[model samples]
Target: MKLLPMFALLIAGFIPLTSAYVDELSNERVFFNKMLEVLPGNWQGKYADGTYENPTSDWQPIEVNYQITSGDTAIIENYVDGNESAIMTTVYHLDNNDIRATHFCGAQNHPRMAGRVFDRSSNTLSLNFVDVSNLQTPADYHSRGIDLKIIDHDNVHVTFSGLENGEDSTRVFALTRSQK
Candidate 1:
């Protein structure tokens, strides 16, 4: 029938459109790999009061160290408070250009998030959330997303989003490269 031929043509036409979308995703994946290429070093951090109404000069300093291993295929990011107790360890890598992180939280679950490049430049790489794992539902206790921006070779900023009373609450950190 004529309708059958028209439907087949329509479906055939969509194949190339889908292929183009895949190619775009491929380009985005390359961007995430570029972000990982600049992330291996020890770093220090200070408070970021989002309100901007208070002075952060008197704020506390913290330690955040990064090191790559397994032939530069994995990065271990450790966060330490003033008391010298390492609080969290996040491992990051690229799976076919889709940046992924497994956050070993102090809590029970280690949530994983897939990231897409939110913004990228010569000095910054920002990753927005694409999807998440280790969460059963919306009410689960897990890190829902992360906003990671690598600023230059020595500075980075991060915001970890979690559910607080059924709403999204974020913990932000500003980090600088540590003097060895």
Candidate 2:
């Protein structure tokens, strides 16, 4: 009779724990799938910064187009007015509870950038780039990083920062989604 009470107690405790575990697993899967879905699609936008001699100069911003493969590989092709195309490949995956992406392009100016997705919701996604190589600006001897925040799936705000001499200089880029 005593064994029956002990078994009941064990089963009751186990049920709640098991239920909580299952719920967590389900939530994780849902979040993962949502993250994957948001990345694999066409993204058309512009990039701009006020670092130039004239902040209001009418230089045409870049046109970004991305093709994401089923294998989580992304091909990013960018076009700037009167300039050749710039191509990059980005691989994205989940690493230790964080979504990470490695971006590689053979540009002499910018070699590679590594980033992580910090926050994600149904309508917004934010990414922060940690590893950046800036090979173009030698005089500045600066390292650059990027941060992107998506709003309403159509508007995106991007920031680029240069880390040099223990100081940081930031430039903001605001873009609207181009409708095809």
Please report, in order, the local distance difference test score of every candidate based on alpha carbons: 0.67, 0.49
lDDT of 2 by residue, 1-180 (tens): 999999999999999999976655454445445545543343554444454333444444555554555554333334334353554344445553444445453343342344433343533233455554555544443335545455545555555555545666755555555665
Query: Which tens-of-lDDT digit does each residue in 55-119 have in candidate 1?
Result: 43455577887778776667788888877677888887777656678888755567777765445
**Could you tell me how far off, in angstroms, the CA of residue 38 lies in candidate 1 after the best superposition?**
2.2
- For every model shown, what is its TM-score relative to the native structure? 0.69, 0.50
* Segments in model 1 whose C-alpha atoms lie over 4 Å from true places: 1-24, 27-29, 48-60, 121-141
- Candidate 1 has which clashing residue pairs, if any? none
lDDT of 2: 0.49
Q: List clashing residue pairs in candidate 2.
A: none
